[model samples]
Target: MSQETVNYLVNLLIGVILAGVLSQYWRLEASGQSLRLWIIAAWTLAAADLFFVARSMLPPDTLPRLIPTITVTCGHALLLLAAQQTAQRPQQRRVICLIVASHLLLLLLLRAVPAMQGWRAPTNSVVWGSLSLAAALVLWRAADHVRPLMRFPAMVMAFQAFFHATRSLLATQAAVDANPVRSAAVQMLGDVEVSLFMVALFVGVLVAYLRQSNDDLRRALANVQQLSSMLPLCAWCNKVRDDDGYWRRIEEYLSEHKVSVTHSMCESCATKHFDEFKP
Candidate 1:
């Protein structure tokens, strides 16, 4: 297969796998709903990439190119939403809507004015880079609220922003007669870099989630242990005394604590209550 084909396959696989993993966690209590937005972003970008690979097969038109731009912009917007949610910040819905609308307007302008086609690449690069940088900033500012391991995803976002910006600058410098071999090599390298970055992002997010989940579990276990250790029970009634100094049945206390209690008489209790019926 051609290098471009290989790149397409690699990116497609990465996107699918990441989306699938996020979907699996979607239903889990510990995986928070924010991840679902991130999954949507991943899928959107993946679909855009797929379109990019198939661009040659599609009719050469403004719409074909515009579709990818729109999808990519939407994906980045979703990423911003995910980051905001992850940091427990108020989602600025108006700002997000404005961003999307502005991008769409710019895209429409580009489509209408053939003279401005040359500016499309740089403009898109700026938009993508800015969104990534914003996400990184959000992650950095919210560090205290998230696990320390979340720094990995933040760093990845920062690097991606830098790469996109640099690529845009480099594209502007390339001569019309640039060496085909060098251009091809650079393009291949960029694809590989992007694929690797996406993989890193997936792993980083997964690790952050797992670490947070583990910490939560540890805290919950500790609370349970502490509760078990200090529980006060009445010797005669077998009722438990809560912190409020109220005496409650053991089952009632457990139930109030969000623990499920099933009623069943123990073997000893059964034998004591009905000695002749003991099996």
Candidate 2:
């Protein structure tokens, strides 16, 4: 098969794998809101890649080109949302909406103005690059404890930003149509890069999620340790049962567990012990 066909197959495979894995995790409730966005983004990305695979078969029309571009851009936006949520950052929904609207407007303008058609590829590249940069910045500025875990994904985003910016420079209308060899090489390189980015992103997000789970587990253990009221105690003997089912005096149990014990008498106990005890 031709190199282009091979690249298309590879992209299709990557997209399907990512979408399937993310969906499975989503069903499992592996995370929360952030993960839900991630799953959606993964599916969006898969759709974009599918379009890329089918573009060669489809007629050379604006709709075919426009569809994948919009799909991928939307996918990037979803990824950005996921990153913002993961970082516990304020999601500027209005700002994101405005940005997406502006991008769509630009695309619409290109479609309406024949003279501006040549600028479509560059415009899309700029938007994708900007979104990648935004995701990188969000990951970099996440909470200190999770920042280290996020750095790998941030770096991946940064690399993708550079790739998109470079692509924008190379994919001008004249350049694309004039030189078939150079364009093919660029396309091949891009497919490889995108696949790498997708896989790296999956790994990075999975690691971050695992870290979050570990943090949650640690917090839960701390809370469990602090909760002593749930312990089984015998009212008559005033003894507490240990985990091993051995009963011991309350003071002895608390002392054995390294808990400080204090002596206090409730009003009822005091009143029963001393007739002069007041409320």
Residue 8 lDDT in candidate 1: 75
The RMSD (Cα, Å) of candidate 2 is 7.6
Shift of residue 220 alpha carbon in model 1, Å:
1.1
Candidate 1 per-residue lDDT over residues 121-203, each given as its tens digit: 55777788888899888888784758365789989999989987987676544423354564565466667876787788877
Candidates in order have lDDT scores of 0.77, 0.80
RMSD of each predicted structure = 7.2, 7.6
The segments of candidate 1 whose C-alpha lies over 4 angstroms from its true place after superposition are 28-33, 175-189, 231-279
Task: State the RMSD for candidate 1.
Answer: 7.2
Q: Which one wins on lDDT?
A: 2
Query: For candidate 1, what is the lDDT?
Result: 0.77
TM-score, one value per model: 0.75, 0.73
Candidate 2: which stretches are off by over 4 Å? 29-33, 112-118, 172-180, 222-279
Which whole-number lDDT from 0 to 100 does residue 25 have in model 1? 76
